[model samples]
Target chain A: MSTHFAADTTVLLGRSMRHVTRSLDTIITTAVMPIAFLLLFVYVFGGAISAGPGRYVDYLLPGILLITVATGVSYTAFRLFLDLQSGIFERFQSMPIARSSVLWAHVLTSVLANAISLVLVLLAALLMGFRSGAGVLAWLAVGGILLVFTLALTWMAVVPGLTAKSVDGASAFSYPLVFLPFVSSAFVPTASMLGPVRAFAEHQPVTSIVDTIRRLFAEQPVGGDIWVALAWCVGALVVAYLLAMATYRRKAA
Target chain B: MTTKPPPAAIHVEGLQKSFQALHVLRGVDLDVPPGSIVALLGSNGAGKTTVIRILSTLLAADGGTATVAGYDVATQPADVRRSISLTGQFAAVDEVLTGRENLVLVARLRHVGSPGTVADDLLRRFSLTEAGGRRVSTWSGGMRRRLDLAMSLIGDPPVVFLDEPTTGLDPQARVEVWAAVQQLASAGTTVLLTTQHLEEAEHLADRIAILHEGRILVDGTLAELKALLPPAQVEYVEKQPTLEDVFLALTQEHA
Candidate 1:
C-alpha cells in the first residue's frame, strides 16, 4: 500500500508539475508582489528606518521570503478549486489507486512551486545588494525551516481550497497571511513598539520564525528561537492537516 | 442438478442516501448484467447522479448494498473501484495537459504497463490523434468530451458509469458519443449510463429504468416500456417542415 501511494503521488505530481511549468505566470505573479515589497522597503523606507547595522535588504530578506510563501500558497487553493470545478476530483477518487495521493500530490506541488518562488525572491534580494555571511550549514538550515513553513501553510491553503464557494474566496485566505509579517519583527523590530500591539507582535508565530531566520543569516546564535519557529510550523501543519483531511472526507463523501 | 446464477456486472438493492433533510436515493434497486447497457432515465433532481456515485464508490450509501463486478462498493471499495470507470457529468480532462497526456495519466494510474501505447491507441480510436498533442483547453467541447470518454476506457474495466455524457453537446457531438458507446457495447463492456434525454435511452440502452422522485418507477426493455403507455394512433396527415428541416435546406442550398 505504501508503495502504491508513492507511485500514485509521483504520477499525480508530474501531472501538476506540468501545470506549474506551463503556467509560468502563477509563479511570476506570486514573486512580483514580494519583490515589490523588497524594493519598497529597501530603497524607500531603508533610509528612514534604522535596522541596526548591515544592509536593510539583508535584514529584510527573511520577512520577504515569508511573504512570498504566503502569496504563493494562494495558487495552491486556486489550482485545487479548479480541479473540483472540473469534476476531475471525482474521477480520481473513483479510480483504483491510493485516494489520499490526490491531495498529497497537490501539497507536494505547492511546496516545490513555492520553493521556486522563494528562489526568485532571493535572487531579487541579491540584486538589491542583500548578502549573508552564514555558512553552508546555516543556509541549509534556512532552507529546511522554509520548507516546513511552506508545508504547514500549504495544508492551511487546502482547507479553503476544499471549502470555498468561489475562486476569490478560495484565494482570499492568504491576504491575512501576507499581512502577518508587517506586524511582526519583519519590518520594524518588535522592541520598538510599546503597547498591546507590541505584545501581540512579539508573541505571534511569524515574529519568532522571522527572528530565527534573520539570526541564522546574520550568523548570530539562534538560541531558543529556532525551536519556537519549528514548533509554530509543525503545530500549524498538524492542525491544518487534520482540518483539511476532515473537510476532504466530507466533501468526497 | 442445481447451478448458481452468475453475479451481475453492477447491482444495487435498497440503496438509500440523504444530505441532512434532503433525501436523494430512497431504496433504489437496479442491476446490469454482464456485457449489456442500462440507461437510467430521470428528470432533474431525480437522484440519478446519487446512484451513479454510490455504484462507482465515490460516495458511501446511507443504507443497503451495491456491488460492481461481484465486489461490494461499501465493504470493498478498492475492488469495486478496480472494476469500474466513471465518466462524470463534466469533462474531467485536465485542461493544461494534451489529450494524449490525459489518457496516459489515467492509464498509468490504473497500472497499465505501457501507458504511452495505451494513450496513443485510444487517441486513434477516438479520432483525436490529429489534435492529441495540443492542450485540451484549446479543444472544442465535442473533442474534449470524446477524450473524456476515451480516458475512461483505459484499463478496460468491466463496468463503466457515464452521468449525462452528452448533456451539453450539440446533435453531431451527441451522435459522436453515441457511436463511441455503441462501440463499447460491441466490445462487450457493461455500461450503466444516465441521462435526462429519453431519445438517448431509446437509441442506446437494451434496458431503460425510469427513476422519479428517488425511486425506480419502471424498469424494462423499450418494447415493454412502450406497452405500458397507450398504443400509438395510426393516422394520415399532411407533413409540415420543421424549423430544423428548413434550416438544413437553406444551409445546403447556400453551400
Candidate 2:
C-alpha cells in the first residue's frame, strides 16, 4: 500500500509539473515582479538609501528572494483553486490512486515551480552586481532557508485555495504577502522607521527571516536569526499543514 | 511483483450519508456480485452520485458497512481505492493534456509497468486512437467522454464506478460509449453506474434500482420492475396502437 501511494504520488507529481512547465508564463510572471522590484529599488533608489558601504543590491537580495517566494506561492493557490472548481478532485476521489497523493502532487509542483522562480531571481540579481562571497555551504544554507520558507507559505496558501469561493479570493491573499517585504528590513533598516513601525517590523516574522537570509548571503555570522527564521518557518509549516489537511478531510467528506 | 485476481467486487449494506441536518443516503443496501453491472436510476439530488462516491471511498458514510473488492470502504479505504476507479459525470480530463498524455498520466498513476502500452491499448479499445494526439480542450464532448472512461480503465481495476457516464453525448457518441461499457462488462469488470436515462439503464444494467428522495424506491431486474407497475394488458395485434398512444387516447377520452 505504501509503495502504491508513493508511485501514484510520483506520477501525479509529474502531471502537475508538466502543467507548470507548459505555462512558462507562470515562472516568468513569478520571477518578473520580484526582479522588477529588485531593479526599481537597487538601480533607482539604491543611491538615495544609506545602506552602509557594501553594495546595496547585495544587502537587498535576501528580501527580494523572500518577495520572489511570496509571489510564486500565489500561483499554487490559484492552480489548486482551479482544480477544485474544475471538478477534477471529484473524479480523483473515485479512482483507486492514493487519496493524499492528489494533494501532495500540487504541493510538490508548487515547490518545484517556486524553486525555479527563485533561481531566476537570483540569476537576475547576480547580473545587477549582487555579489556574494558565500561558498557552496553558504549557498546550500541559503537554499535550505528559502525552501523551508516557501514550503510553509505554500501550505498556508493551500487552505485559502481549497476554501475560497472566487478566483479573486484565491489570489488576493498574496497581496499582503507580497507587501510583507516592504514593511520589513528588506528595503531599509527597521531602526530607521518611526517608533511604532519599528516595533512592529522588529517583532514580525519577515524581519527575522529577511535578516537571517541577508546575513547568510553576506557571509557574516548568522547568529540567532537563522534559528528564529527556522522556528517561524517550521511553526508556520506545522500549523498550515494541519489546517490544510483538515480542510482537505472536510472537503473530501 | 505478481498480480492476483480480486474477490467479491463490491459489497454494501445499510450505508447512510448525511450533510449536517439533511440526509442524502438513507439505509442504502446493495451488493454487486463479481463481474456484473448494476444501474442506479434517480432524479437530480436523489443521492446517486453520493452512493457512487461512498462506494469509491471518496466520501465517508455516516452509518453502515460497505466494501469494494472485499475490502471494507471505511476500515480499509486505501485497499478499496486500490481496486476501483471512478469516472465522474463530467469529463474530468485535464484540458491542457492531449488524449494520449491523459491516458499515460492515469497509467503512471496506476503504476502500470508499460504505461505507453496501456495507454495505446485503451485508446484503441475506446476508438480514441484517432483523437489520441489532440488536446482534450479541442475534442468533441463525446471524444472527451471516451477519454475520461479510457483513463479510468488504464489500471484495469476490478471494479469501476461511472457516475452518469453518458450524459451529454450525441446519439452516435452514446453508442460508442455503450460499446466500451459493454466491452468492460464482458471482460468481467464490475460496474456500478448512475444515469437518468431509462433507455441506458435498460440497455446496460443487469439489475436496476430506482432511487427517489435519497432512498431506493425499488430495485430489481427490468422485467421485475415492469411487473410491479399497474397492469393494463393490451396484447398488441397487427392493428394495435402503441402503448403511449393507447394511454393518451384512454386518458383524453375520459377527460
Which ranges of candidate 2 are over 4 A from the true structure?
A: B1-9, B232-255
Per-residue lDDT, model 2, residue B106, is 76
DockQ of 1: 0.90
Candidate 1 lDDT at B91 equals 91
Model 1's alpha-carbon lDDT is 0.93
Clashing pairs in 2: none
Q: What is the C-alpha RMSD of each candidate to the true structure, in Å?
A: 2.0, 6.4
* Model 1 stretches astray by more than 4 angstroms: B1-6, B238-255
Per-residue CA lDDT of model 1 for A44-100, tens digit only, reads: 988998878778898899999999999999999999999998999899999999989
On a 0 to 100 scale, what is the lDDT of residue B193 in model 2? 92
Highest DockQ: give the candidate number: 1
Task: Give the range where candidate 1 chain B is weakest over 10 consecutive residues by summed lDDT.
Answer: B243-252
Interface RMSD for candidates 1 onward, in order: 0.7, 1.7
